[model samples]
Target: MENISLVIMEKEKDTGFLSRELGSYEVKYDTEYVSSIYASREDENLYVNMYLTVPGEFEDWKYNAILDNYDTGLYKDKALLAEEDEDSYNPGWVIKFLFLENDNEMEEKINELLGIHVSELERVLSQLKNIEDEYRD
Candidate 1:
């Protein structure tokens, strides 16, 4: 079993458009990542965000490769074209909801957002944790 933490927040009923309106939501924060899952029935959309931690030592090629694999279409064109600067790279990504028709759909979307699988994410996170633990030794 992989080590992970999942907290399901409150169920927010009809509260208007999530993008334009502020609805009941929860934010999960940590040193490596900060995620927010918004469940707005009115808009029938669940917004997802997983801000990744980019190591300062990561080079331009490696960073661009990650973005290239993750972003779709013109969604990341600007970042792709941007010059390589240690101060300019944004490490976060946006994962729009696939289907928000029901609770099960939302769960599935959460598990498989960002064009990355849940198992892959867990494995990567576990490896990162192990590396950090070793650094402290």
Candidate 2:
């Protein structure tokens, strides 16, 4: 079992009885796919996996995770909705790991999952520093 919000967060996007997906980032009106957030770990390596819905279908983008199809990659922009919903993109985040001994492992997995090369997870790194700073004070 999980928290109410946690369970809903794990869903493609919580749906109302009318089948309307609603949340803080609900894809209402002219919107594309919903987003899924998850935390992962491997031995001492930890990471986050964000699954954004496919345009027009609200479907998982995993099928598009092919290097050859990089041009049509789902994670190319790393969760870009559609041209109309650009302003709604607020750089959402999830606390993925407490400790990751092999730093490069997460990057490698992200690269493989997104069908691209990623040197680092800059946003998370910056946020991690912020968290530590807060603790220091």
Candidate 3:
């Protein structure tokens, strides 16, 4: 599994229509799965959005399986998966999670969220590898 970390690039308060504190983060990962990370905190809710891109050609079933895993997993209630866009040039998946702000454990909560994402990625990679090994047999 690749080590995933969020490096905050910049953060500022937006005073526009929907006032919120916005943050841009650089996702440090060994694989090319995550492309970008953005976060916003409004009221007591902190929303984290991650853009993920899987390399090579992925079958629709495999893609749906991953989604199903997330849907039934621990993050099912907190995470929301954006609809896939097939017409985009660089097709990717956007996953958004809403976390209630706990002043004392904010950092720990963020780390836990990242750990969950890493776990999912590891699971998918393991499945893909097993399939590839079977084809070689």
lDDT of candidate 1 over 1-137, digit per residue (tens): 34344443334454443343322222222223423334333354444333333334444444444443432332232222211223335444543333344555544434433224333334444455345533344
TM-score of 3: 0.45
lDDT of each: 0.38, 0.30, 0.51
In candidate 3, where is summed lDDT lowest over 10 consecutive residues? 18-27
Error of 1 at 12 (Å): 11
* Candidate 2: segments with Cα more than 4 A from true spot: 1-34, 58-137
Which scores greater on TM-score, model 2 or model 3?
3
* Order of quality (lDDT): 3, 1, 2
lDDT of 3 by residue, 21-58 (tens): 34322233443555665566657656665665555565
Provide the lDDT at 128 for model 1.
Answer: 53
Q: Tens digits of per-residue lDDT for model 2 on 1-137?
A: 22122111222223312232222222212222224444444455433434433332211222222111223233444432212222223322222322223435443433343332121222323344335534344
Estimated TM-score per prediction? Answer: 0.36, 0.23, 0.45
Off by over 4 Å in 1: 3-5, 8-35, 39-57, 71-90, 98-101, 114-137
